[model samples]
Target chain A: MSTSAAERAVNYVILIVFAAFALAPIVTVLAAALSPQSGAESAGLAGLHPGNFVDAWSEGEFSRYLRTSVLVAVTVVSVAVIASILSGFAFGTMRFGGSRVLFYLFLLGIMVPAEAIVVPLFYDLREVGLTNTLWAVALPQIAQSIAFGTYWMRAYFRTSPPSLIEAATLDGASPRRVLWSILVPIGRPAVMTLTVLAFMWTWNEFLIPLVMSPNGDFRTAPLALAIFKGQHVQATALLAAAAVLVALPVVIVYLFAQRHFIRGMLEGAVRE
Target chain B: MRHQRRYLPYLYLTPALLLFGTFLLYPLVRSAQFSLFSWDGLGASEFVGFDNYVELFTDEVLRAAFGHALVLILFFSVLPLGLGLVIAAILNRGQVRGLGLFRTVVFLPQVLAMVVVAVAWRQIYAPNGTLNTALRAVGLDELTRTWLGDYTWTLPAVGMVGTWVQTGLVTVLLLAGMGRVPRDLFEAARLDGAGAVREFFAITLPSVRGEIAVALTLTIVAALKTFDLVYVTTGGGPGNSTTVPAYEVFQRAFREGAVGSAAAIAIALTAIIFVLNVIVNRIAEGREE
Candidate 1:
């Protein structure tokens, strides 16, 4: 049905207004980061000063934190994606005793809030002398991502054409070979979505790194930004710069692979 | 071969199961154990049974923290749901030009780290921040206050940040749901002498009931799980006005040395989140049938 011209006009107007509303705060921060540190909270265009990011980077030692974030994200994404593929393939294609029960247990990882477990997980890690190590942060997140990853990939695999698998099986291919050589190649989009998601979550994680790295050995970018905020309460420009630095990696990733990111988020909701 | 066939799936599942057992399931069991004892992290323990749970019900600060979370639901979940429904329905109906660009830009907030969001908003809500400056520039000097510091406004202020971050997500999700809606449904409604509003209410609303439920479940859980936003923006501050159960879990366990109390609160929060999600899902499922 054709929408009225007036209705379409109203739609565009509303869309523009809400889009501005969404971008306003971020723009405010960007403008502030560009302005001089002394005055002018958000200089619109003329008063550009780009040194705040450099200063904040060196002062807050954000390089170390960002590097740590990369390491943790790479660790979590690589392991979680591989593990999810294997387990998701099993859940999607194979039947075994207690499979139903095992799936539910995995579901618990997704359902239970991190706050519910971080306390004990911290102590458990500390007891094993793993606190303040990269493992403390990455391990739990790997497990959490695998939980959703397994669920996501299982859905993909369940709907995959059975004929291909049957053909491979008749040709004397093992399940491992089928999954590794055939399905994984065809399932690149699904796997890519999981990788992007796991990377985003790992990059943005705060509570785990905060609690786990008490000695400041493995603090990630977001945690460093928060701590920097506490110390530099008055330096709005520097803080904005740091916030931008911390958020830039994910924002950049989102920009390039937004299709995968949006698809993963919306599809996850729809499947539920 | 028969024996191997039965256990092959298990072999594939071993890595995932091992991770879950070590990190998730094991830790949960230990957290429950910690909740039953009154022990500092370094000292001997005493079994307090249900006392910590009792304290959660009685402590004014703790109760207020959970109460703040409930109030946050209004801004975070309910407000966003209402707003997203309107925006998404409009987008779907108009099939507006440059839909891709609009979706990409508007949905940007959902991808950023909460710390970044909190920081950006902190600048906006500072006493001399953008919000107050805008207020002053527009001749509303008397209306300004330190948003994150004011006891009366801090909770709502923090909650608005949640609203901003979550609205994009809800809008994007609902838009996807609305995309699946067949055009003939709207055409049929228009044929029956329905106005745009009538068409929306009669067809659009009911069609996306499942999406609405999914939106509510995700947003409500986000409201309850809010820690980073509150931690960075207000620190449950001025008083305990902005604290939530998640923040309390961290504060009690780490700062106050109330390990048992923190675990109890965490367990209670998890139960509330789980139960609420189940209700939302069940309602959606019920309506689907």
Candidate 2:
């Protein structure tokens, strides 16, 4: 496996080039968002400025969109985490007939792409008078998150030492109490990883909200940015600013939970 | 107590089952039923039987969409998986400084909204954008053309963006897989006079087979359902050159009011995905056994 210095230099060069290509577009948008003018015709490296951000904020209705996005993502993540913990504990710890079958059935949700179901989901939601409501967005996402969250927490619980659960059971802890007091306390890392992932995904989701609630009132950040793109195709600087605003939450989440994100991805890939 | 124990598993599964049936399973069946009848979002339905499926097979536009998806599979799945493995290997060897920063930068695209990625890349691929400018600067002016707007190259160009966004995920997955390879295996190879390339093919590649399979499956699935990027960047335009199956489905159901046709397309796409998944899982299982 030994390599000469020249070969090593070549390897580094390749890595650097690939990294640059990977990051170029994102960096370009950040630059665009900071630029001055608000038209694609005038946009370029020379037009780069920060003043367009203020204009974009007002014109894109980004503040309101941001509020909606945060509310939806937080609610989805919170509900998903709690529901998953309960279900994961029950499936992982309690032995009963059809447990494995039911678990696999739940995993089937992973394969059912949202695109395939949007039509019916739209009709069903409209029937319930839930269309254009935040509940429409949050409920579906919570449903989707349960599959992965349950799978993840189940993995976490299976790997946990049995002595703890047994000890809790012997101490007169009910199944619910054991989950709340014993399992959840030890499942913090897995919970945090799931939370970060769920938050990022729910925040970035576009199609669900787009079809479920197209009204400007219920528009999430990504949907808002999309609508902004359609209406303001000529407003390049403002679009860039809105794009940056849309990306900010994910960027911040990555900065704080980069390691956990990596861990979560790796863990999911390896296990499945 | 025995009866309680017997019901406990169902109890545990009730929440997931309810959600899955309502959201995932029910929609799947309903969409299938919808595919047998013609209806708009607001109007009366008429049973059209298998006409929708037949039309999907015969329609030139739908055929082109499938073709585009196949092309995208090359850019999104095949190329990304190959290049990602190379990048992951180099990073694993400690050949690059600031490895953590590099990993973070590469993975940044996966977190960004597709709309944002599309907007940024669309600018870069514009007629007088960075790509063309770079080509001209390198004395390759003749090669310079509108990257996205051009009919012949639009699909490939869009696929390339997909490759960029996805390579990071593939690289990180492979890198994690590589970490699981025993360091002593490489040390042993070096002692036996194995060179870098030989060691990679023999020691590194074989050891990370599971990861390669995982990366391939993920990238393949992502490629098949690619919509947002294409929708934002091209709208499957320039005579539908960049149209993919998912985009076609969206256009039919929403824009064209062809609900039955769209559902048929979705069911067909799902079948294709399911078959691929089974094939991949079987290969992985075979390797394990």
Best by TM-score: 1
Q: Which stretches of candidate 2 lie over 4 Å from their true place?
A: A1-3, A38-48, A270-272, B1-9, B94-96
Instruction: Give model 1's docking category.
Output: medium
Docking level of model 2? medium
Clashes of each: 0, 2
Q: What is the interface RMSD of candidate 1, in Å?
A: 1.5
Individual DockQ of the candidates?
0.74, 0.57
Residue range B52-167, candidate 2, lDDT tens digits:
89987799999888888889989888998889888777667654567788788888888888888888888788787778988999999999997877888888899998899889
Q: Over all chains combined, what TM-score does candidate 1 have?
A: 0.97
lDDT of each: 0.89, 0.81
Over 4 Å off, model 1 = A39-46, B1-4
